[model samples]
Target: MAILIGTRDGVYRTATVPVEDAEQVLDSGDVPRVQTFPELDGVFAATKTGLYRSTDEGQTWKNLNVPQEEVYSVVASPDSERLYAGTHPAHLYVSIDDGDTWAELEGFQELPSRDEWHTPRHRNEAHVRSLGVHPEMSDRVIAGVEVGGVHVSDDQGETWTERRDGVHDDVHHVLVLGADEYVASCGDGLYRTRDAGQSWTSLDTDLDHRYFREAFELDGRLYAAAARSSPGTWSGEGGADAILVESTDSGETIETVSYPGGPAEVILAWTAVEGDVLAGTNDGRLISRDEDGTWVDAGMIPAGIRSLEVC
Candidate 1:
């Protein structure tokens, strides 16, 4: 058995695993979004061409015609046999009958002023950076656009509404635990909305001028990754660096963890296992400063880690 991985270098690597392990991978390839659907006894990865599925743990592959240029984010529907993906240059694709075929989500694409794509430093349409699916409601999904803020989908990806009622204009990451509970990472800091995004309050905690990047829920607490703001910025840290913060009471209070990195740059994108949190830093290293206070440098991935999904 083996686990498959695709890299930005345009190569796919496979890792061998024991048969006793239920989640073993036999192979992997040049895919962007990796997802495991055990019921189908297969793994799916989305790339520039389309979606690929492997019935035997990625030993071989078949294409599922969901054509697009750059598939940046992918999500699975819990309510039915469907898949959703967000692509570069502003496009959302939905597959209703499994991953075999897809169509451009007209409702999501038809959103008002959505055609104006913009990145952190560039402008175009809305470039979705990250995506989230509500835990309690499978039909509810949200996307974090680089410059367009937050977008929410109440009926899967069929329709999307801007979730900017109380959010900043630039949103990078979003996590929705329930209908009334959502967490967002923006250019300035972190904010949480308890009233279904109708009203929001910024968590007035200290983060050393870091722009909140990624967030995850572990042990009933929320942990977030924040990078120091770029030069000439005055949000958190004054340079292009990053750090981590943990919150136990939703978004009320936070505790900052001081990881040993320098003034140059920093990013903490990780692959979270059952009990392990492995992160790849921007400085070309893979290390983890876990909640248990035992920092471990597992080795290195030698690649820029964009985000980590616990699959």
Candidate 2:
């Protein structure tokens, strides 16, 4: 087994599973997202430059032909041969030949809010920050567009319905916990829905800062991280005043989780393997908690990490 870390510089791999063993395997440039497809026996890196694939773990990689210049995220459909890529300017693409070639999902751009989808940084455009696919319902796919709100498609990518009621529009990530349950981490706060996006309830309304990015579920417990504000205004050696939050009862209640070294950085990536949970910070710090709940430094990456996955 190996842990794959996608960083601002490149992709790193470590079969040792411990952070200390991680080493750069592919220098494809600014890997914003990395994912593993066990059914295909390979891994993929959605880089700032292009999309790459590796079959022999991470020892080798090949660039795939994608219409977009920047692939921000890659996800595998339940059907092994089908794959999807979310790109800059917030466009979605589908690949049926395992990334060999991609076709633009034109229907995505026809949403009613397309004209209003603009990022704070670029102002002229936005990005597909995150995507979630139902485990049992392969036809359903939900995409979280930065500053664009959430869009749900029940017939694969053929059609879409935009839904932003009750939740913040600046969605960062969407976690599909079940067929009807979803948890969203956004620039405003965390939101949960049990009616398949028909309605939503904000969970972290009382938080001082609500720039949440990612979330994970392990052993019936939910974990997430938040920054005092957006990264655009973050400063000081401590980075954003980021904090970790946990929920044991499916997000009905949440409690702050303090790290052993104190909260000094922003956590952008999270993953769990064999019941062990790990988190990576935006300041090149990697750490994990012991069984007794003591946080320990794992190791360091060459640059800030954007995504993490186990293969």
Candidate 3:
């Protein structure tokens, strides 16, 4: 097995943890996500430059040439008939020919809330930070925008409905749990919607850490990490002052867990390998849970890891 670490610099592939002999597979800048679809041939990397795919594991890559330069997220349709690419400036594109060509999903720009999606921190522009689809809902598409909000498409990106009314607008990622359920990690708070975004429940209402980047689930348990504030306050003496929380009964209740880099390095990405949870930190640390349910340091990469994929 190979672990593909998507870092701020590029994507690195290593066969073993502790990452002693990691290789830079793709030089694309600032990979925000690395994903794989069962219908697709290989791994896909969403980078600052473009969307790329690697057929032979992570050794070499070919740019998919998404129309937008800064591809933030990529996912294949449930039937593998269409490929979606979300990019900076908060635009959506689709490819019907297995990424050979692309076309902008213009309906996304028609959203009434599009004008208010900009954030000054991100150069007054937002990016589609996350895209999700469940196999059961083949025609549904869920998009989480960094400075915008969560939006839903019922006809596979042909039209969109604004589902950001109750949820925080600064969504970092959205984990699609089921056809009608999702957990959104946002800058203000973490939210859960059971009715396909008709309404939302704040999962972090009672927590001190409001800023969340992502959430993961393994063995019927949900794991999430958050910082006291945003990234700007992470460089303080206490670092990010982050905390890792686990919820066995979904997000109704959570308990704090101590890890190798507590209150300093926040876990930003997660992926499962051999039934064990592997997490990547904002400080470039890789930790994994052992049989004893303890997280141990696996190793570190050159740059902070934004995402991870196992192949």
Candidate 4:
């Protein structure tokens, strides 16, 4: 299959399409900040209103209804039949039939709160930032709230348990590196929980900055992106200069993948292409790392990207 690349500055920019004009879409009125799915055959993009699907390797896109809610993230269960999406107003949207239709997961409206629920710094916004769905157990899903710590749903979102024990409550992202083992990007930095969400032990001590953008594993190693925002570097340019940290044993130990460039750009929204393990930088660049943890520039992508994932 020949890959054809296109360019878009903000919206649907590039397409490595085939001549057949299969399913290729990236257009206006569509805010696809992030895309990922359990079914690697299709890339599910998280848009402002709903999710989009592309079966033909992003050659084209089709919208799925999920109006009025901002889709922060989406994940396909390892079980295949179940799909999960986290959206604003703190709702865990679920779909049982591929990417057809979605329903609000039961009891999603019942997450515990301090009566006045809001994000730590940005009190106006309250949303689930990340989701850690256990690969072996579909019923057990962990959700990271803006500043409300982590919430666990044992019955597939039917009922929830706030498992912030031994872990930071201001959780941004939760990644299950293995069965019953987890890691969270939280207020106190990187923390790991061995027995599901029951308890945790902090990793990478005193790495200040509560903002942990995303987490994923490559070649059996766990990786996460962090940024230190400032005027010229952070917020967008220099402010976002952060260290890309990795762990060999489910976050037991830490190391830096920091090379020449910094990760101020939203790293998670970019697609982590399986072959090159490409990571999209917020500064409009595509970088890839091999199994040996070496970094090299691959290309450039759209600006204002959210994160990267494989289909």
Worst 10 residues of 2 by lDDT: 257-266
If candidate 3 were superposed on the true structure by all CA atoms, what would the RMSD be?
0.9
Candidates' C-alpha lDDT: 0.61, 0.83, 0.93, 0.61
Error of 3 at 141 (Å): 0.4
lDDT value, residue 22 of candidate 4: 19
Best by TM-score: 3
TM-score of 1: 0.79
Candidate 2 TM-score versus the reference: 0.95
- Name the regions of candidate 4 deviating beyond 4 angstroms: 1-24, 28-33, 36-41, 114-116, 120-123, 206-210, 229-238, 263-276
What would the TM-score be for candidate 4 when compared with the true structure? 0.80
Candidate 3 Cα errors over 4 Å, as ranges: none
What residue runs in model 1 are displaced by over 4 Å at the alpha carbon? 1-7, 10-41, 46-65, 120-123, 230-239, 260-265, 289-291, 309-311
- Residues 1-311 of candidate 4: C-alpha lDDT, one tens digit per residue: 32222222223334331112212245533342444544445666665565666677666777766643566567777677777888766677888887677888758667556343475465465677777676678678788876667778878777888777677666667777766777787645777877877887878675644456557776677777776532234653344667777777777677876643564453543234535455655555556676677876665544444454443
Q: Rank the candidates by TM-score, best first.
A: 3, 2, 4, 1
Better of 3 and 4 by lDDT: 3
User: Which candidate ranks first by lDDT, i.e. highest?
Assistant: 3
Range of the 10 consecutive residues with the lowest summed lDDT in candidate 3: 16-25
Predicted candidate 1 versus true structure: per-residue lDDT over 80-192, tens digit per residue: 56677777666778887777678888787777867555754743555566666754777777777767777778887788887676777677667666776888878777888
Q: Distance from true position, residue 244, model 1, in Å? A: 1.7
Clashes of 4: 31
The C-alpha local distance difference test score for the whole of candidate 2 amounts to: 0.83
C-alpha root-mean-square deviation, each candidate: 5.0, 1.5, 0.9, 4.5
